[model samples]
Target chain A: MIKIKLLFAIFALATAFASSAAADMAIIVNPNNAVTKVSSDEVKRLYMGKTKSLDDGTRLIPIDYVDGSAIKQEFYDKVVGKPLDRIKVYWSRLTFSGHGRPPETLSDSARIKAWVAGNSDAIGYIDTTLLDGSVRAVLIVK
Target chain B: MSRWRLPLLLSTALVGGGATAAELKWDGFFTSTYSITNTKSTYRDIVHDDGSFDDSRFGLHVVSDIHPLWRLEAQLFAAGYEDNYATRLDWGFASFHLSERLNLKFGKLKYPNNLVSEYYDVGLAYPWIRPPHEYYSLEEPSASITYESFSGASAIINRRSGDWDLVAQPFFGEVELAESDANISKFIGIKLSASNDLTELQASVAQGRINAEGHELDDQTKRIASLGMHTEWGSLVNYLEYAVTTFSDSEEARTKAGYITLGYHFGHTMPHITYAGFDQESGWGQQSVTVGVKQMLNPSTALKLEMQRITPQLNPEAGAEMASGLFMDVPEKTRVNAFSIAIDVVF
Candidate 1:
């Protein structure tokens, strides 16, 4: 009975991990871009308007999802590492101070993917399930 | 051409060229606060026994990249504390993005003396309804020297290393104090800041000459230095700042002030406490403790309630003439309590 119970527990743990992995979001860039991978810190800096270019001097145009979107919430939670309200306050500080501008926001993942595919400088995030050949995933946010 | 004609023509051209002109962005923030103190003496021109809305204010910010390398920005602000809520151009500057790491700005710009000096008027940007009075107030009325805006230029340099981002800003300008008709001339300062996801540190120094008509501080050469740190660990937040001001001619005019704040986030609510104090060479000073709670009504709005206890102190060695501490018509030794409620929103 003990052996059977241990096996069941392991099965449950594996299933949970699988589902969590399936729910992950992907930070995407144009497939033609030279960049292949990105760290969570880099993503946060780009999204927060702290840096305007990549390490290789490539100008980065970060794109964000519209407010109140589930994908946007997940990206901010997992990658940006700040709550929505705090993020708003951060952007307000930068915006009003004329230090930086928030990224232009699109409505949905499909539109973001289209924009990223068309513009080599654009970087955005979408659900991993929405992944396609048009854009390349640089980082997976779990 | 008239001074206004150039901007008029530019606006017309930008409006007519739909696809060529960069998109202009408009943002705004508003804050309303009601506060009252138990004491008979007025505080900061607003807090008294009957309550006042003097903390309320509205501001609109506009930005546009008129050219690939040039940006124009301005803010229109109105505050209840000002006479009749008159709207004023709080900041109007043009920025030249010289390179990826360097930028230059000219015109009227926000004074970058302290941590929150640039966005102090934007209540939604900070947890406090009003910044701690000890280190942020004007020295003539309080114990510190701080200015709102200046007319001149600045150069900002950005550097990134590993996870830390660094910024160095050197500026020069002159400021006119509307409340007291004082002027700060030949002002020059440099601020250095470093930040990561969880922590930020800043240090700055400035030198200027203060000239006030019919005031004791006339033609005084003043120097100021400040240090600040802010950090967040999980749900815990902390802020610490210290500043000192000195005069070249008068040792008795030196002042030191500082404040520390701690807050914890519980879901959408945060409870915070701050202890602040200031000491002047002339014996006038005060210590204050504030307890506050902020409730996030939404992503763009917050409602806050705060209660503060202020205790005035005077040093006999410095002299009896310097008895009042940030208050008018108050007894030498009296503690005052104040309560306030505020709402801040940004869009």
Candidate 2:
């Protein structure tokens, strides 16, 4: 009985790791754009509104997932150098001061993908599993 | 010959072509501040003499992107000063971007003598209830040492390492004094700033020379130097800055002073304490200490309560005479403790 219980525990742990691996996020852009790879610095500056245009002078429109979403946390942690809580406060100040506006928030990855595919100048990130051929993954945020 | 008219028309035509090709964008900010103070003596108070919102202000910052590499920006600031409305053009300039790391600026700057000087006018950008007067204090009542804040050319360069961010700037300009009789021409100066996230630590140093033309005696030449630092811990932010100023004529007349501020955030409220001091006739010297609490209603608005003690410890004679100098309006051997409450907002 003890041996059987041990095997079951191992199986559960393996499955959990697999689920975590399956949720990796990918940064996506419209397929029509010619640019491919983007440095982590560039991505952070774009999302933070520090840089108004891309390297090619193409106007950039960054989109965000729903607040507190796992993908949102992953992107901010790996790229933006700020946590969700700090970002919310930063956005509040910016919005209230009328200096700038936060990126549009989508309900889920499916909607984010759909919108990015439609807007040529738009950029967003979504789970790799939720991605289809409609939009191209420009760079993986890791 | 219409040679002058031809160039004028050609310039207009070129401008028209560019306007049609690029899109014009607009951006700005609106902000307000209120504060209240308490004093032991009602006769010598310097804070809110009336009630809350004693020093309320509003500003509009406008920017227009003309091209990928050029832009124009301006700011209009207004506040209630001396029981009435006072307004001024705070900042106006045009910038040309040579590259990502290098850019040239020609216009009026807020005398980038300190890191906080640029955004000191934007109250909402900082967590503190109010900007410490120690750093923002003016040498003259009209904010003119020379007719403008600092109108000239400036260059900024930055480089970031793993955990270090470095910024450097050099500028030259002239400031107009209150009388406008003498324009203080600022000599060349270089400022270096560096910060790190591990401690949110920032430090800066500046050195400059100023020359003002006066007919009575020799030109009053002055050398100015300052050092500043800011750091953050969990919910607390601390800042301290010291500046030393001396004149060419008086070797013993140099003055030195500094201020310290400690602020802690409690979700919605932040209580802070500040201490400012300087030596008198050091050409420029004063001492003041303020303690305050700020409650941020939201990201846009806040309320504050502050108390300050103003004393002239260096120049006993000037203190006695109420010399009417910058920050030396009170009599010597006397300290003014004031209490005040204020409300601030940005939109």
Candidate 3:
């Protein structure tokens, strides 16, 4: 019975870990865009609104998932290098300074995929399981 | 040909609004602080017994993205907690983005000297209920020395080079001092700022000709300069600021000031200590030590509680007759201890 209980605990922990696997995250861009891969620093800069355009002088529109999901946390932690709340503060200061805006929010991954697919300048991230030819994953950090 | 740029941009903005889409975005912040000082005499800018909310303020910031390259920004700030609070146009400016790294702006803008210098009024952005008085004080009434802002033209350059991000701004402007009924002109300044992921630093120098008529002060040449730095290590944050100002036409000239803050964050709570002081060549010096705790109520709001011990030093033997900055316009010279609780919100 003890062995069975230990196995149950291991399963629960594995399930929790699997829910937020960074490997599942893929930074996706519109397939029509020429950019192939994005560096981690570039990703950080774009999301943080430091660089308004890509290195090649192309304008960028970054999108975010609205829900407080593990995927959102993983993106901020691994890519932006800050927690979700701190990012909110950062965006608040920037918005108050009239310097930048937070990324437009979509309700879920399907909407993100649809939105990025339509706009050539748009960038969004999603679960690798949702990857399709409709969107090109430019950088996979996880 | 260059003179037509202003009218051309204005017409473009108006026509562009009718033709293509233009975006108007706004953000706001509110801060309420209740403070009481122990001194019996009433200080000009101090809140004594009753919760005057002298430093409490509400701000609304707006940005109009008329074009990809042209944008207009403004901020309306209101102070005090009374229902009849007065509002002021703290910033109303237009920015023309020359490129991804360069931009030009005109109108009234924050005179950026340090990290908190530009946004000291925005409480939601900083941990303190109020910034250290030594460095970013209101410069008026022969008191507050940090001139918050000026009106004129400025060039902004932002570049990211490897690990260091560089920001350089050259500005020339004039400031109107209402407290003393004065106006400063021919103000030219250059500020250089750099930051990495963990730390940021700034240095600035400026000189302006001042014209004033109030309380035995007038026609002064003002020179101001400052250096500041901020660093963060995990949950620990540190801030240091040093500034100096001199008046060639006044007796109480040459004021030197600095402040240091050390804080540690534990989850939503931050406990910190701060020491700030200023010494005027006129023989009056003042210093204060503050201990505070900041608690984030949510992503958009925070609560801060702090206490401070203020000490004023006036030396008659130094052959100076007056005090500047906070030491001015006080009924009597005395020490004071003060406490404040503030709530800040960003929306």
Residues B182-216 of candidate 3 have per-residue lDDT tens digits of 77788788889898878889898777777766643
TM-score ranking from best candidate downward? 1, 3, 2
The i-RMS of every model, in angstroms, reads 0.9, 5.6, 2.1
Where model 2 places Cα greater than 4 Å from the true spot, the runs are A1-26, A32-42, A49-122, A125-130, A138-142, B1-17, B20-31, B34-48, B51-54, B140-148, B177-179, B198-218, B251-253, B281-286, B312-328, B331-333
Point out the higher-scoring one by TM-score: 1 or 3.
1
- DockQ for candidate 3, please give it: 0.53
- The Cα error of candidate 2 at residue B216, in Å, is 9.2
Indicate the worst ten consecutive residues by lDDT in candidate 2 chain B.
Answer: B139-148
State residue B259's C-alpha deviation in candidate 3, in Å.
0.1
Q: Classify candidate 1 by CAPRI docking class.
A: medium
How high is each candidate's TM-score?
Answer: 0.90, 0.72, 0.88
lDDT of each: 0.83, 0.59, 0.75
Fraction of native contacts (fnat) of each candidate: 0.74, 0.06, 0.41
TM-score for chain A, candidates 1 onward in order: 0.86, 0.82, 0.82
Q: Relative to the unseen true structure, what is the C-alpha lDDT of residue B292 in candidate 2, on a scale of 0 to 100?
A: 79
